[model samples]
Target: MMKFKVLFLLTIIGLVTCSVNAQRGVRIGYIDTEYILQNVPEYKEASSQLDKKVQQWKTEIETKLNAIEQKKKELDNESVLLTKELYDERYEDITFEEAEVLDYQQKRFGPEGDLMIQKRQLIEPIQDQIFAAVQEIAETKSYDFVFDKSADVVMLYSAERYDMSEQVLRTITRTSKRSQAKSKKERQELEDEEVVPVVSADKDERQQALEDRKASREEQLAAKREEREKAAEERKQAQQDLRDAKKKEAEERRQKVIDERNARSGSTSNEAKTVESDSTAKAKSIVKADSVKVQGTVKKDSVNSKMPKTAAEIAAEERAQKLKDREARQKELEARKQKIIDQRKKAREERERQVKKNDSIAKAKKNEDNN
Candidate 1:
């Protein structure tokens, strides 16, 4: 997550860097590599040679493979007529030929193969020459950076003023002329030959190449757009799923709370039934114990028939004991219920906080991607 934030910050910083480069009057120029390659005589010849060689190798490989297939077919067809020894020998011969053909293909076209070697050998030098020219021009002009407009860089807008393609082409022309000339007369002739008009074939090819590049860039942009739209749709779907899951969880939690409350109520009711039965038995025991007290009261009453002791005093004491016991039991039940409620409230609050945190993170990530 922190890495994503850093990447977002870096992207913003890159935009600012470009703006700062402009404000500071940094000398950044660009060139068309395609144009340069198109004009370079050596590169054109090397590319043509490479294409010819590749075609030749491809035809040779195909021919050998076809020969192997034909031989194997003949061996299979003649298998029933030939003796076991003869058939085995013919099979081995076909197998060897097939192996040889495959080996040849791999030598020419496999990983770390001759085709790749030939490509690097032919192309790398031309690329190095171009790079040297570009670097020399950059150093002499004190340019901050030289961008290749022909490559796969993406740009929404650009100005023509920063294009140094013509400048680079002129340098290449002069350099080529210098390398080809020996005397002053030839040098002068080449110098005078610099501004010849373009042939129609070359002009048409150049136009076609530029068009192809434009078409390719458009395809790439379209692909990128499709990918972005797909990603956004996926994110939206994911968020919706998360919301649904969260809602279902909340519902389950609510149902659980209700079930727990119902269970507690049922348990309390059962407890109250047991307590009532116990209280009735205790009341009968008290009645039985009161007979002795009444007998003693009768003896005392013989002396004084109208007793000063009142029934209200005994009633008040029994009422006071019952109230204290009832309050204690009520406090215990209330404490148990409150504890459950408090625990549930804490759990719910924590879950909500976590959901909010995750949502905030997702929003931040989405915002970053959009930017």
Candidate 2:
């Protein structure tokens, strides 16, 4: 009884395992981070402001670099005329000035460059807060996995249905607002850190205009070169392809002519055979007719010799016999001519049919060969 109970327990466990396996399945979702970042007003405002700030910093760095380069050029130009002592003194001065410039630049825009880094740092936490909310949503909704929709890896997806970015953005915006409202000191610190000495507004504008002009000229030159190269390559390829196509067409035409000549030759040979047979038949008939005439002439001569009669009677008999011989020869010639004409006609018709059949066969073979 104990063994039977154990076996029943094992069976119950197996059934339960199968039921659990059937019920278990994963739910997955996707989110478009870029869409969320762009559509959310707070994120849009922050991103635009950050871009402007970064551009300003980049322009300032460019101006500084240009100034340094110009100064170096000036030093090089002066070095040729100066005495060693004077040159050394001037070089020391320039070196000191460069060191000062570098120190100031590093202090202002080093690892702790401007308030932008701080702003990004602050904003990153807010993004993390949104990520946390997304995680919570996934867990609560029984989702096993969630993927970022803006990523390159997610090439195709259900557009509207897969996007949870809007909800995530809203959560982030609310969190950021509440966090800012709670921390006045941090906001003031951010504000204070944003103040930095920058180039004069007019000079900055003039420099930017110069840079834009230079960039535009470079772009135009590069584009013209690219266009010229592309046009040349296309022309070369087109000429090559034209040559290849012409060669192929010429080959096909030559093959077709060869096939047509073969068909004509075969038809001509068949017609020649028919004509030869008809000629032989007509020649045999002529020989048979000539033999019969010879026999009749011999028989007539013998009869004339055996039976002597009046001259008028003999003349009338000869005339009648000559007329009969003439009629017989004419009938034999007519029958031979008719037979030759009929044979010629049948040969012509057969040749025509054979030519047509050969042409059709040749065409089919040509098509098969081409394929």
lDDT of 2 by residue, 1-371 (tens): 99999999999999998886456545556777767666667667776887787678667766776777787788789888888998888778778777777776775578776664756764676567668868866755555678876677645537464466766775566555556754787666554543333333356447879999999999999999999999999999998797678657866876786688668767865776686677657766765776676566657767776776767556766765775686677667767866776786687678667867876786677567545
lDDT, each prediction = 0.74, 0.70
Over all chains combined, what TM-score does candidate 1 have? 0.42
The 10-residue segment with the lowest total lDDT in model 1? 195-204
Give the lDDT of residue 344 in candidate 1.
Answer: 59
Error of 2 at 149 (Å): 11
Q: State the displacement of the C-alpha of residue 366, model 1, in Å, after optimal TM-score superposition.
A: 75
- Scored against the true structure, residue 231 in model 2 reaches a CA lDDT of 100
| TM-scores for every candidate against the unseen true structure | 0.42, 0.39
